[model samples]
Target: MTTSIVIRDEQSADAAQIAAVTLAAFATLEISGHTEHYIVDALRAAGVLTVSLVAEIDGRIVGHIAFSPVRMSDGSAGWYGLGPVSVAPDLQRQGIGTALISEGLARLRAIGASGCCLVGHPAYYGRFGFSNPPELALAGVPPEVFFALSFTGQTPRGEVVFHDAFKATGPTPA
Candidate 1:
């Protein structure tokens, strides 16, 4: 069975639902090593959650993704960080997550992001033009898996440091 989903930017009031979706998305995944619900809450609290997109169907949110600010060492340079992309377990592979990611990336570029980076599955993020940052790989990162895409001059060279909240989990809720 298949279902249709619509993607849209998240509203302020959707915080509760957004957090809930993230919580549910990571409830069963130990890949993150622990629950990620706390990360989502922290992101919301930090006020850096500039971009959020959701995939909804029949009034229910089935997928969610967020974009926050990331900076290079010394915090002098910046790039958008993509993560916590979640899809309802049952709705995985229906393109809901993809839509949310696409919308968020578009929004970031529109808002003047120089580039975007994320710690995610190379196979997945690679499909969207996110490739390892070889120019200035983050310390301890394989570089091949730490992908980046520049919207301006060069893939903003520097280590990819996502929000502190992002490291608290495996991109489940944060």
Candidate 2:
């Protein structure tokens, strides 16, 4: 049977659970540096997590997604980066990730965000209207995995720089 999932903005009390879920989700992924939990914490501490959502099933947090401000070399504004999206390993392929992403994108638009971009599997993001535009790119990332979705129909041209919080690979200094 499928469990009911509730999507909502994360609360301060959910921070620890969110970190656990993120760690579990990416633990076995070969490409993951296993630092996603740190990234989320860094984003939160830096005050740049434009959108942070969690999926809860019967009071247990199972999935999470984060969006943060991104800078475009072409001087575009209101663009955000999507990533560190996590779902419980056992819950993979059950629409939890999809729900988090869909809701996150909708929330971004509601807040006047012009666009969102991410480096993810090409096949997964296409369903959400993400495409690798010729004019927009992320340095050091392959074009195929760099996808962008423009809510205002204007795609920016130039390098996309994700928030510096993405560089967090360990605990933040006090």
- Whose lDDT is greatest here? 2
lDDT tens digits, residues 1-174, model 1? 266787887777777787788777877876564445556667777888888788889889877888888887645454877877888787777778788888888898888887788776768887888877667676666766677877876665556677777655444333
lDDT accuracy of residue 128 in candidate 1: 88
Q: For candidate 2, lDDT tens digit of each residue in 1-174? A: 278999999999999999999999999999899999999999999988889999999999999999999999999999999998999998999999999999999999899999999999988999999999999999999999999999999999989999888999998675
- Please provide TM-scores, in order, for all candidate models, with all chains considered together: 0.84, 0.98
The Cα error of candidate 1 at residue 162, in Å, is: 2.0
Q: How much lDDT does each candidate structure score? A: 0.75, 0.94
